[model samples]
Target: MNQTAPATLRSRLWWPSAAALTIAAAALGATLLLPRLFSDPVGVDPYVLRLTGVAIALAFVALVWSRFATVRPILLAVAAMTAAFSVFAGGPQWIENISGSRFDFNTQVLFASAAEALLTAVVAVLAVRTSPSTLRPLLRLRRFGPTALIATIVGVAVFVAVVMLLPATLLGREGIAPVALARDLPLQGPASVLQSFAQELQFRGLILGALDRVAPPWAANLGQAAFFGLAHIAVVYQGPGAAFVPVTIVLGFVLGWVTQRTGSLWPAIVIHAVADIAVTVGVIPGLYGY
Candidate 1:
C-alpha cells in the first residue's frame, strides 16, 4: 500500500487529525479561561498560563495545516520534534515534577519511554493509513539522507555547548534547575540513553520539520519552541503575577529556532537532555559542596 494514504481507510482517517486539532484548540481555550475555572486559587502561576496558551495555539495551527494537500512532510516533522522534546528536554523535568513523594529517574524514564512509544505509534499509523491531505503538515525537507544526519550531529553539538556555557542565572528562579548526568540513572542506563535519543527525533526532527515548511525560520522556531516549553508545564510552578510565562515562551522560541536553522533536532535534544542530566546529577563534587 502507498504510505502516503491507504485508499481504503482514507474516508475514516480524517477524525484523527481533526481530533488532534480540536484538542489543540480546547487546550488553548482553557488557558485563556483558567482564571474563571479556579476559585480562591492558591497561587496562580503565569508560566502555567503561558504553557496552556501556546499549546492551544500550536495545535490550532497544526489543524489548519492539516487541511492542505502538500504539507505531509511538515506534519511528519512537527510530530517528530514534539516527540523528541517530550523525552529529552521535557522528560527529566517531568520526572522531577511527577515524582511527588516517590522520585526515581528509572521510573520516570520508563513512563516517558512508554508515552513516546504510544505517540510514535499513533503518528506512524496516521502517516501510513490516513488521507495524506487530512494529516499533512506545512513544512518540507529541502534535503535528506546524509546531509540531514550531519546537520543533526552538528546542531546538537552546538546547542549542548551553548547550554553548558549559559550562565546559571539565565534559568531564573521558576526556571529549570541546572542538572547533568555524571553517574547515569541506576540500572536504567541503556534505557535512559535511548530515551534521550528518541526525544531529539521527535522534537527537533519531527516538529521542526513541519513548522519549517509552513512559516519563516523565525516564526517556525518561535511556534514550535513555545510548544516545546509548554510541554514542560508539569514541572515548574510560578506565582500569579510572576513573569514565568514570558520567560519560558522566550526560551522555547530560542530552542525551537536553533533546531530549525540547523535542519535537525539533535542540537536541541542533546543540549536539552544533557542540561537536565547535569542538573539531575547536581553540581560537581570537586567544584563546591554540591
Candidate 2:
C-alpha cells in the first residue's frame, strides 16, 4: 500500500493538470484585453501592450496556482512567449534606435537571440524531464513565501531610498538629468513597480525557475547568466564604447549568479531595477548627454 500511494497520487493529479491548462488558456486570452484598453491612452505607447500582457499572464498564473498547480508550466510558456515577443518588438529596435544605426538583424543581437532561445529551451526540457511530479517542474519552489515577499518589499524600499538619496557618483554616474526622456525614464513610481515585477517574473521566475529543476545548480546558474548577457546586448550598443559590451555581459553573469545564490529574485530584481533607474535617470544627461 505504501509503495502504491505515490503512484496513486500521481494519477489523481492528472485531472487537475487538465483543468489548469484550460485555465491558463482562458487567462491568456483575457490578456488581449490589455492592448485594446491601452491602444490610445495618454502618453502610452503601443509597445507597452507587451508588458501588460506579461503582467496579466502572471496574475492569472498566481490566481490558479493553488487550485491548479499545472498552471505553473503553462505560465512559463507564457513568459517565454512574452520574452520572445519583447525581443522581436523592442530588443532589436532599441539597439537600432540607440545606436543611431539602421535596422539590421545581421549583428550580435541575432546570435544572442538564438543562443538565449536554445539555452532556455534546453533548460525547460531538462526541468520537465527530471521532475517526478507534474507541477514540480514549475511550482515546486522552496517555500519562503513570507520571507521572500518581505525581502522583495524591503529591497524595493532600499532601492528607492538609494535612488533618491545616494549621490549619483556612487552609482558610477553624475546626476539626475537623463530622466528628461520620459518615454524611457518614465517618472512614475507605480510604473516602476510594475516594470520591476514584469522583469522578475520573466527572467528569474520563469527562466531561472525552469533551469532550477533540470540542470544541476551550477550549470543552471551559468546558463541563465549567459541568457542575461544576451538580453542586454542592446545596452552595450548604446554608444561608441564597443569595449563596454563585454562589461555589460559580465555584469549580467554576476546578476544571474546572485539570483542563483539567493534562490530568490528579490536581490537581482532590486539591484537591476536600481541600476536601470540610475542609468536612465541619473546619468545620460548628467554624463553621457541625451
Candidate 3:
C-alpha cells in the first residue's frame, strides 16, 4: 500500500511538472533567440515576427489556463518574461541609446522603474489568479522580527565591505566621492528602494515560491539564485567585468537564503535596498561607485 501510494503521487505530479519545465524552456528560448533573429544583420521577416508573437500569445493563454490548477507553469512564464524584458527593453544598449541629459542616474532609473513596474503587475495578476494561499507565506511579515532585521543589517554591511574591497583588491584602486554621493542621495535612495522592492517581489516572492512547487526547497532556492545572477548580464554592458556575474550570483544566494529562512521576503528586500543605498552613499569610501 505504501509503495502504491508513492507511485500514485508521482504519476499525478509527473505531467504537470513536465509541462512546467517545457513552458519555461520555451519562454526562455523565445526571449533570447527571437530578439537576435529580429535585430540588425539577421533581421527576421515581419511575418515571422508576427507568427512568433502569435505563438507566444497562445502559450501565455495556456499558462493562464493552467495557473489555477498548478503554480509552476505560470511562475515559469512570469520569471522568463521578466528577465527577457529586463534584457531586451532597457538593457545597456537601449540605455546608451536613450541617455541624453542625465545619462548616469535618471535614465537608468526611468528604464528600470518601467520594467520593474511591468513585472510587478504581472506577478500580482498571477498571484491573484492562481493560488493566493500559496503566496501568503511569502507575503506574511510575522517572521520579520528582530533577528531578521539584524541579519539584514549585517548582510548590508558585508555587501558594502565587498563592494569597497573588490575594486582595491582586484583592480588596485578605490572609488569614492563623499560630496557627490551626498548630492545624489536624494534621487538615488528612493530609486534604490524601488529597484530593490521590484527585484525581491519577482525573485524571492514569485520565482522562489514557484520553484518550490516543482523541486526540493534547497534546489528551488539555488535555481532562483542562478536565474537572478544570469539576469544581471546587462550590467556587464554598463560597466564592470565578468567578475560582477559571480559576485551577483553569490549575493543572490545570500538573499535567497535569508528569504527562505525568514519565511518572508521583507528581510531580503530591506537588505537589498539598504545595500544599494549604501553603495550610492559611498559608505565605505571605495573606488567602485554604484
Candidate 4:
C-alpha cells in the first residue's frame, strides 16, 4: 500500500511544529556554535566552515527523514542558507582578486551583496526545473501587499527612532565628520540596502517560509530568527561583534513576527537596510569592514 503521510502531521500544527523548534536550535548549534567556540587563532577556513555547516544540516535531514518529517524542510532551509552565506562571505575575495583590489570597501561590499542575491535567485530558479515546488515555498519573493506597505512605513519610523535613541557610548563617536560621511553615502547606502535585502530573503523568506510550512507560526518564527541571529557571528570581528549577535537574534525575531503578521518580507528588508546604513555611518570601523 502506498500509504501517504499521516493526517496527524497535517491536521494539527502544534506538536510537530513545537518539536521542530528544538531541532532547529540543535541545528543552529551544530552549524555555528563550533565556529564561535574556535573564533580565535584557530581560524577555520570559510570554505570549510560553509561546507561543514551544510553537510551537517543535510546529514541531519537524512537522519530524520524517516522519523521526523516535520523538520525536513527546516533542515533544508538551513542548508540553503549556509550555502548562500558561504557564497556571500567568499564572494568579495574573488571580486577583489579579479579586479586587482582596486575597489574601495563600499564598492567591494556592493559587489559581494549583489552576487549573493543574484546567485541565490538564479540557482533557485534553475532548481525549479527538477522540482517545480522547490523554489516557491522556499522563497517568498512575491508577497508585497497593502499591509506590507504599511509595515514599510512603520519600519522607516522605527529606524528614525532607533537612531535617535542610540547612545553615543554605543557608537563611540565623539564628533561627526560631515564631509567623510557624505562621501561614503553614495556607495555605502546602496551596499547596505542590497546586503539587507539579500539577508532578509535568506532568513525571513527562504528559511522562515520553509519552516512555516512544517511548523506552527511561532515555531517557524523562532527557527528562522535563531538562524538569522547566529548567521551574524562574523560581525564579532566587524563591530562590537560578540554583543551584536544577541541583538541580531532579537532583530530577526521581530522581523519574522512582522512577516508572520503582514505576509511579506519587505518590511523586514526595509528596516534592516536602514539599520545597516545607520550602523555603518554611525559606528567606527574595526578590523573587519562593517
Candidate 5:
C-alpha cells in the first residue's frame, strides 16, 4: 500500500511540476533570448522592458486552471514574482520621473533597491495571505544558528577572495580607486545590501518557498535558480558577458542549497550582498552606475 501510494502521488504531481518548470523556462527565454532577437522588443510598460504581460497571463491561468491545482501556489508565486520584478526593473524610471533629475548614483541605488524590496514585500505578504498554510514553512526568515552563521562566514569570504584574487583583465576592471570607494561605500554598501536582500527574498524566499512545498527539494532548487540566472541575461544582451549567465546559474544553485541546508535566509542574503558590493566597487563606475 505504501509503495503504491507513493507512485500514485508522483503520477498526480508529475505534470503540474513539469508545467511549472516550463513556465520558469519561458520566463527565462523571454528575458534572455527574445530581446536580442528583436531590436525593439515591446514591454508591459515603459519601465518593464519585458515579462509582465506574460506573468499576468500566467497568473490568470493559475487562478482558473483546476488541473494543476496541486502546484497552484507555486504558479501564482512565480507569476507574482515576475510582476513584482517588472516593478523593480522600472523603479529607476519612476524615481527619476518623480525627482525630476537623476540623483547621485549611490542615492539612486538606495531608493530603487528600497522600493523594490518594499514592493516585493507587499507581494510576498499578499501571497502568504492567500496561499495555503503549507507555503508558510518554506519562507524561513526565523532560522539562525551555528550552521547558518558558519555558512555565511564561509560564503562571504569566498566571494571577497575570488574577486580580489582575479586579475583585473578577467574582472573587466580598468583600475581601482580606494578614495572613490571610501567616498561611495557609505551609501553604496547599504544599497547593494538592500538590493541583494530584495533579490534573495524574491527568488529564494518567496518563489523557492512556494515551490519547496509542492515539489521535490532538488527540483524546487533548480527551478528557482534557473529563473534567477536567466533573469540576469539582460546584463549580457548588449555586452560580451554571455558567459556570465552560466556562472550566475551555478551561483544560484549554490545559494539555493545554502538556504536549504541552513534553513535560514540570512546566509543567502549576505552572500548575495557581497557579490553586489563587489560589482559596485569592482570597476568604480564614476559618479553613477555608468
Candidate 6:
C-alpha cells in the first residue's frame, strides 16, 4: 500500500509537469513562428515580440496548472497574453496598415473577428463538456424574470446614453447627420448585433465560466474583463492611448458582473449588442469628429 501510494502520487505529479512543459514549448514556438509567417519583418518590434513570447509561455503554464490548482492564475495569464498579442499581433489595425484600403480593413476585421468567435465557441463547448462539473446554460429564459428584464433595460439604457454622450463630453466631438446614420443603421445594426452575441458567448459564457470553476466569482469577472479590454485596444483607437483600455475594461467588468449575477449571458449579450449597434449607427461619433 505504501509503495502504491508513492507511485500514484509520482504519476499524478509527472503528468501535469509534462503537460506544462509541452504547452510552454508550444507557446514559445508559436510566438517565434507566428510573426515570421504572417508579419513583415521591418515593422515587427523585437521587444514586443520577445515579451509576447514570454507571456504566452507563462499563460500556457498557468492553463495547465488550472487543472490541478486555482484557475485565477490561468485567467491572469490569459489576460496578460491577450493584451500582448493584441498589441503585437492578431490585430486588424496592423492588417489595415498593410492592406491600405478601408474596404480591405473592414473585411479583414469582420472575417477575423467571426473566425475567432467561432473557434472560441467550439473550444469553450468542448471544455464544458469535458469538465466534471455542470455549467449553467448560456441562456436561461426561465431565470429571466421581471427583475432580470428590468436590469437588462436599465443596463442597455445606461450603456446607450454613455456612448451617445461620450463624444460631446470627453471627446469634444460634434454629432454627424442623423439622416446619414439612419441610412446605415439597417446594415450596421444586424452586423453589430451578431458580433456582440459572438463576443459574449466567447468571453463571458466560455472564458469567464471556465475560470469560475477554480476562482472566486470576482476574480473570474475581473480576469475576463481585463482580457476583453486588451482585445479592444487595436480595434478602438488609432494609436496607443490611456483612455481606451480603461473604458473597455470597465465596460467588460460591468458585462461580466451582469452575467454572473443573472446566472446567464443573455442580459450581458443584449446590452453589448445594443451598445455596439448604437455606436455603429453614429449615436456615438468618432473621436474629435474624425
List CA RMSD, all candidates: 9.1, 14.3, 6.6, 5.1, 4.1, 8.9
Identify the runs in model 3 with alpha carbons over 4 angstroms from their true place. 1-26, 33-59, 71-122, 132-137, 140-143, 167-176, 234-239, 278-290
71-178, model 6: which lDDT tens digit per residue?
323333343334433442364666677766765544555544555455545544544443334322232323566666777999988876766656454543345677
**Candidate 2: where are CA atoms >4 Å away?**
1-172, 175-189, 234-237, 240-251, 286-288
Candidates sorted on TM-score, descending: 5, 4, 3, 6, 1, 2
Least lDDT summed over 10 consecutive residues: which range in candidate 3?
Answer: 1-10
Residue pairs with backbone atoms closer than 3 Å in model 5 (clashes): none
Instruction: Count residue pairs with overlapping backbones in model 4.
Output: 1
lDDT of 2 by residue, 243-282 (tens): 4456555655665665665556666666666665555455
Q: Which tens-of-lDDT digit does each residue in 1-290 have in candidate 5?
A: 11112445655665565687676557746664555466645423342445656666666676577555555556656655566566666666677788867586567767777876777677667667665454342667878999999999999999888888877766656556678879889998997887787788878987677666656779878988987886676422224556667878889889999998998999999999988787677743522334
Could you give me the TM-score of model 2 versus the true structure? 0.44
Q: Write the per-residue lDDT of candidate 3 for residues 1-118, one digit (tens) a residue.
A: 1111234543454456445545654554455446666564332342233323543564456456745345433443455345434443444445776765546655466466556656
What's each prediction's TM-score?
0.49, 0.44, 0.66, 0.77, 0.83, 0.60
**lDDT (Cα atoms) of all candidates against the true structure:** 0.47, 0.49, 0.57, 0.64, 0.70, 0.56
* Model 4: CA > 4 A from native: 1-7, 11-42, 47-72, 123-138, 234-239, 284-290
Instruction: Please tell me which predicted candidate would have the highest lDDT against the true structure.
Output: 5
Question: What's the lDDT for residue 229 in model 2?
Answer: 50
lDDT of model 1 at position 266: 50
Clashing pairs in 2: none
Using lDDT as the measure, name the better of candidate 4 and candidate 5.
5
Query: Which model, 1 or 5, shows the larger TM-score?
Result: 5
Any residue pairs clashing in model 3, and if so which? 174-287, 175-286, 175-287
- Candidate 4 residue pairs in clash (backbone atoms < 3 Å): 236-241
In model 6, pairs of residues that clash are none
